[model samples]
Target: MEKMPAKQYEMGSSTSTKSMQPQKFLHSKRIGHMDSFSRHEMMYDPPSMESKSMPRSSYFNSSKPWPDLESDESDMENEIDIDNLPPIEVGPHEHRLQYTYWLWFSRKGTHRATDYSKSLRVVGRCASVQQWWSLYSHLKRPTALHPYRDLSLFKQGIKPMWEDPANSKGGQWVIRLRKNQIDRAWENVCMAMLGEQFLVGDEICGVVLTTRSPECSLSVWNRTATDHASTTRIRDTLRRILNIPVSVPMEYKIHCDSLKYVAISKGPLKS
Candidate 1:
């Protein structure tokens, strides 16, 4: 009366097994249910919303933690501020020069006598740096100068003529600045002279600025025409400081030699 029958026990065991199997499968199947799917999506790919709808601090404010949108946004704003900032001024070496140009009008080969007279009437001797700029700022660019027009710049004490005692025996390291290179070329010339970058130093009598057809000219003058050492140093220094391109050629000429070349090349009357 107390023991259960074997058949009855078997029936109970089979029924329990069938119920347990279905129960196990229910968990997996239920994962696709709406709430379960929502949970899954929340953990994975949630919908995107406009950044503006959230607290402004969520993106830019500095006061939050975890997903500190505030700090992030503030950082981004700061980055934009930095990016939009005006350029910082560095020292001279970091900056490219914006040059001021001077124009010269010569009565002889440079221009017609009438034009020379007009320029002379309007031109005043510019002795100081400020005065030079005042004169230069109003003048035409080098490339715009007349084909026959010549422009020259000399130190305060110096004149453009070779006969000037300071220049009489002097030589020049000449770079013919093509019309296209007027800006950089003229800047280099001005930097060299004003900075006194020439190795010849005192041998540096002055500089000459001339604009002619097809080119503008910048010449570094030395005190001694026959001083080969000074002339060599001058030319080498120019080659280095100007960072002159290898494709372009340069020439060094003694004033005496230049005069001779002019005589032979242009004719006796021109010389």
Candidate 2:
């Protein structure tokens, strides 16, 4: 499929055009991790004292524990059942997006440092506009999610974590929004990212919507915090896309600073 020119996404232009035909791109069926409910059921047993004493680094190990491995495989088996769900019909001509994106969900764990990665799960993936809508339509609105829950839409292959290789040297533009503003703001940012409206090329990593008590926040992750020009463009483009007023504060926090904070909070490393 021919890529749509970046010019097509310039400010003030409509995101979609009549000339763009939906190209047939294969949708990846491997949605990572199970839904929160199923995962919670599988992990009902309390953490053992031995497990708690294990080095914190072990929790982030690339290898999965036996029970988690079993649940992961079972979740893969259920992907076949997706076709049975209520159909979200798209015409033969679907609008192919510039890049495939994955949706991820996470809930804060009892331990802030470790629970995050353990709770992270891939909700679904989409390569075209129709598929994105199909996945999104089935999800509860941001307003419905409980506090401490996060919904992120990231480019495929990039995990929404500070330690991920793509994100390790980067930072994010964070914008806090009122409870009532989340739904519209989240949709607008996702559409902007998928449409390549940021114009930062591959520098743009993903967008996240985090729900919290009384307020919610959205963050746009990028590949480099040192590239002032690109980062500035992203911040400006984000403001334009979200139509956020100047009064609403936007905070930029580097991943390294965040890592330092985590390390300090966790205290000295155990031998």
Clash totals, every prediction: 12, 1
TM values, all candidates: 0.49, 0.65
Q: How many residue pairs of model 2 clash at the backbone? A: 1
Candidate 2: tens digits of C-alpha lDDT, residues 92-140: 6665566778777776653365446666765566766655655555567
Please identify model 2 stretches exceeding 4 Å from their true place: 1-92, 110-112, 269-271
Report lDDT per candidate.
0.45, 0.62
Per-residue CA lDDT of model 1 for 143-236, tens digit only, reads 6655554456555345566656778777776676666555445544554554445545567766666666655667777788677777766776
Highest-TM-score candidate: 2
Report the C-alpha displacement of residue 110, candidate 2, in angstroms.
Answer: 5.5
Which 10-residue window in model 2 sums to the lowest lDDT? Answer: 23-32
